[model samples]
Target: MTATTIPTKTIYAGTGRRKASIARVRLIPGSGKLTINGLPGESYLQYSPNYIRITYGPLHTLGLDKEYDILVNAQGGGLTGQADAIRLGVARALCNVNPEHRGALKAEGHLTRDSRVKERRKYGLRKARKAPQFSKR
Candidate 1:
């Protein structure tokens, strides 16, 4: 008896961060579909067109929107931060699939991680840098 071996699909992975959010993304060769935290991206993103568009920026830039499937696990931060993190993760995974894509992705600014986070509150201050109001007696 002869045994047949099945081929396994290869997956490319990337990690991205924005503010306090982090996203781990995987790319597999398949029909265009995006899932986040085990839910369809559109549903997970609450059908927000803006978010959907932002999340697909890298794919759209490379004209490969319908060529791959994306899976993402994102945590921390707010909705906007998560969306941006996913975008960066997708762009990185695309680059991993093809290093040549780096130039394009870089030019599109998807490779840059936004580092702006909430400022930490300082001691004896109302806010990060604001001070309590004072009046001379």
Candidate 2:
């Protein structure tokens, strides 16, 4: 009788938020590839180089850009917010893979969550801060 065993790859998870967007990211061992909400990352991001670069910033900073496949579930907000969220998520996931990477990621600002969001409109204002035109009679 012969016995065989299968190798299993570990999956690392992290969550990130920016503005109103939230992203859940997973890191799996493989050639570099990114998928968001079941769609190819490039197509989902509208093929924008800036967005692509933003999402991969952490990996590049650590020189691990081609070490893993990234799967993300992102929702809410615009593309920019989602991209930032993904960047943070990836950085956090890398930290899980190896905590030593934290300092590098933090230094690169990839671990910071942007706190800016839309301001609420005041009851007497036309917009968030716009006031009615002055009437000099």
| Pairs with backbone N, CA or C atoms under 3 Å apart (clashes), candidate 2 | none
Query: What TM-score should be assigned to candidate 1?
Result: 0.91
Q: Write the per-residue lDDT of candidate 1 for residues 1-137, one digit (tens) a residue.
A: 11123377778888889999999998888898999999999999999999999999999999999998999999999889999999999999888888899999999999999999999999999999999988788
Clashes of 1: 0
Candidate 1 has an lDDT of 0.91
* Model 2: ten consecutive residues of lowest lDDT: 1-10
**Distance (Å) between predicted and true CA of 43, model 2?**
0.6
For each candidate, how many residue pairs have backbone atoms clashing (under 3 Å)? 0, 0
Stretch of 10 with least lDDT, candidate 1:
1-10
List TM-scores for all candidates, in order: 0.91, 0.92
